[model samples]
Target: LTPELKCDRPDLRGNLVIKEKAITYQAGKEAVTQLQFERAVSCFSKAITLQPDQLQTQFYVERAEVYLQLCDFNSAALDYKHACYLEPQTKTHFHRLAFIYYLQGQCLCDQGMFLDALESFAKATELKPNFKPYHMRLACLTALGRYSDCIRLVTNWLKIDPPSADLFTLRARLYHQINQAALCYYDLKAALRLNPSCADALSLLEEMKEAAECSRQQAVSKAVEGELTNALSKITTAVEKNPEKAQYYLFGIIYRRLKDFIAAIEDLVLAVELCDAVAECSEREKPDNSNSLEEDAQAQLVLTYNDFAVHCFSQGFYSEAIKLLTKAIHEQRDESGLFINRGCFLKQEEWLFALADYQQAEELDPQNRSIWFRLALIHNTMGLHSFGKNFQDAADKFSLAIKYKPGVAQYYGNRAKAHTRMHRMEEAKLDALSALILGSTNDELLRLFPGCSLSDVISSATAQTVKAQLMEQTQMWKLAGRPVTEAVRKVLHQRQSLYRTGPRLSPLRLADASEAALCAAKHPYAWRNFRGLGLNC
Candidate 1:
């Protein structure tokens, strides 16, 4: 019969002489079995109308199933909800209702109606509390960035079911999204423990390790090139990819190098916390296998302490810098660089302590040029502060510097100055000549003796050659009032004329009196000539 005719004859009797609704319900089930969803829906609707007060819960459930097949989600949901109300105590009824809501949620999710889909899936989970509905709800929550909700839901579900690898992996990924990296790693490790062959968990772990290594290499390269901003960017990406101890340690180091002390401290502290967490997690593992992570973390912690001390020193916080360095030294006594760096800071305020640190560094690394150089510089500076009384000390330090780095001209020049201050004229002259031979400037020689002529200080042959070069280059007789020295004039000439390329030399490079006096007595009009030429000197 046609659907219209069947609807018009709804009052017809059944085989038991009961209401026509039972016969119509049977026909709807037959239509559903045949996959004629529209015909089944129409027949179920007519049966429900014919026996509105006496309708069985099966009528609504059957129609809901047909509506689901037809992809009419709203109708299916309404019928399933009604079936739930009619058979509230039946497990089968609620399970069927949950299935319909789950299907509706899937359709909504496909349509990009995430909030609606989330509601549907949540209701399904609430009704059934099954794995499929719970998983679907978590997917919806995750897609919506509802991390806290997803975590709570998964955590509650875990209480009901024994731990599964896939479920743990899902929760771990959710924790990762929320930046709870330690917790994420904890869950991932747990997942691995449950099922060692879980490919997805293993792949994620490997990716994090690779990303951390790549970031560390890139950061180091950029920092070495003095590209601090790019280095920070690389380390930041690394931290995002893997919020592990090594990555945080490297990030802290980069921040310290960039002189961002506050950020460096925060990252370093976090790194230590993560290290502790990792240690706690791994405590149960085999003792004979060794923990490389723990060793690396401890090393990084010491390095971070040393680097932070350097940062403090750069900002002139000497006491704090020394304290931090002391802590680092206490932790790792074999680090020679730390001793040298701490000595540098202590040298400013505590000479004795500085000496002790330098001596320690020397013992640790006898052949290190930098340690020797720093020791010599500190001694030289201290001696200079005592006027001529400390000339022997200054000279001794300069000698040590020369012994370690024999080719350095500055060391010879510094020693010559110390010898001059002590009135050891012959020794001073010899050292001065050695400095000159080693490429020390004539200006340094002139500074050592103010009133003496270049010939009085050195051989006339050397004096005359330097004098001739000065006269040709500077015309130094220009300044009428100054005492003239040929070597000084040569230095002045280079500064005032030769080194100046264009219209004028920078004010900073202007020739001073000692340099300008080499030929000042021989060419008195040179100053006027210079003025007429628009030269500032």
Candidate 2:
């Protein structure tokens, strides 16, 4: 129990343990013969701990072979290094050690841990200065973007080994990454001499053949500088070099800028087809919305179709414009803007189709106020055509529109017409009055009261003037005090909601001395400068 102290002198060794060490060594040799690697390693380790051979390398070599059987590479490598040290003439032991390091480097590289892989590879290269380890280390350096290190490694490799076509070509690429074009060219040329049919070298040579570059990137720069013709020329050469999906898309963009709609449409359509084909082959992974090539191409196509359709509409080709928009709608059904635009064209003579389009648009974007307003317009127009049969639907749609965007005077004006058609006089008067006060140029109201200006309506003498004017036109319709005053109060309340003590504040004050028919009012053109609402027909 003295903790088994080791004797520094060989003569001081205990006799019983010295024989046991020999026995352990013999047992290890027997375990190896029987292929029991774990037991062999255990026995050999104990033998070495008891009586390690310093002069003779047999002890390390035997344990190293057992470690190899167990695939314990690190331990096997350490044992072989000791063997190499004891017998400096045995080159195989050094090779075995380097091979173990190489295997470790390969394993780390496969796991994408490039930095660790580089360390292992560097150790392998230092042990055995050969092309294989050098090349492996170069790969790790390249992966880590240590291009300068890779160049130095390759340079060292070139000095040691005979000329290799692959090595030269690879070094050329490393030079290229660091933007050393002259050095890259020299390496590529050297590679060509070793093997004239080297494909990679030949390809790189062809890319550098174009003067000032035929890359699509160059074309993009030209396009940005507003040189469409020159940009088109560059992109044409790029397309010839590589007719990829992105190339066709760039071609489409250039054509669009040139206002050559026919060619633009063709190229974009091809881009969509090519992108879809690639997606299909790759099992159609969900694309990121912002950067998806297919989405961008299709979106551009929709816009082009919209502009072309509008142009056709202006040229009085209504049917052709409708067909174009119909194609656009088919292309991008989720686009609520497309449906609303198409409905505007159909509103001319094809009322039912317009109604269907607006309904579909509503389903796609239920919260969009433009869709709501378009629906209201279609319904009101239909009610007018059918003699007030759809006035109630028209009123409801306008209310929905107003609920989302409460300050649009056009919405209230149209709703007032619907309410008047439905014989709801109270609602009609409130809406009509609100519409005029909020700056609606209600054409029907204008036709009814031709002499009443916007200034006259908002001025202090508005009450008496409106009553006298309305009575002069239709003496039978009696003007009331309470409803007219309440309508004015509601308009002021709305004005307060929009502007706080600003130039937009309403000028009219409520003296509760009002008796005027709202139908006697005209378009409020004076306040039109406040805000303009975007309403599509």
Q: Which candidate is the best by lDDT?
A: 2
- Where model 2 places Cα greater than 4 Å from the true spot, the runs are 1-215, 280-291, 388-536
| Model 2, residue pairs in steric clash | none
- Per-residue lDDT tens digits of candidate 2, residues 1-537? 243444444445567678988899899999999999888888888887887566437778899888877867788888988889888898888887888888878888999999988888888888887537444877888889999998887787788888798889888888879867656777887899989999998887566545324457788888889888988877766554444435346367678666687788887887787777667654356344323676677777776777677667677777877888899888866666667777855447677888898888778766565665666666555545654566777688677555544555677777888877777876775666556666777668443335866665545354345445433423222221113455577666757654466667666644443423332232211111101112145
Cα error of candidate 2 at position 73, Å: 80
TM-score for each predicted model, relative to the true structure = 0.48, 0.40
Estimate the lDDT of model 1: 0.69
Model 2: how far residue 165 lies from native, Å: 24
Per-residue lDDT for 1-537 in model 1, tens only? Answer: 999889767555333334466788888989988998888989999888776553557788878878888988788878877876887777787777777778888888888888999898878878876646445867777789899999998888788889998988888888878877667777888899999999988887786768767987898898889888998888776776666544446466667666676677678667656656655665575343234544544565566676667656667777887888788788667667777778855436576688778779878766565666667666655555553667788788777656544545577677888888888876676666656655567686765656865556555465456445434422332232144655566555556565567754333333577655754533322111101111110
Residue-level error in angstroms, candidate 1, position 184 = 6.1
Candidate 1 wrongly placed segments (more than 4 Å): 1-73, 108-116, 138-160, 171-187, 239-253, 261-322, 332-537
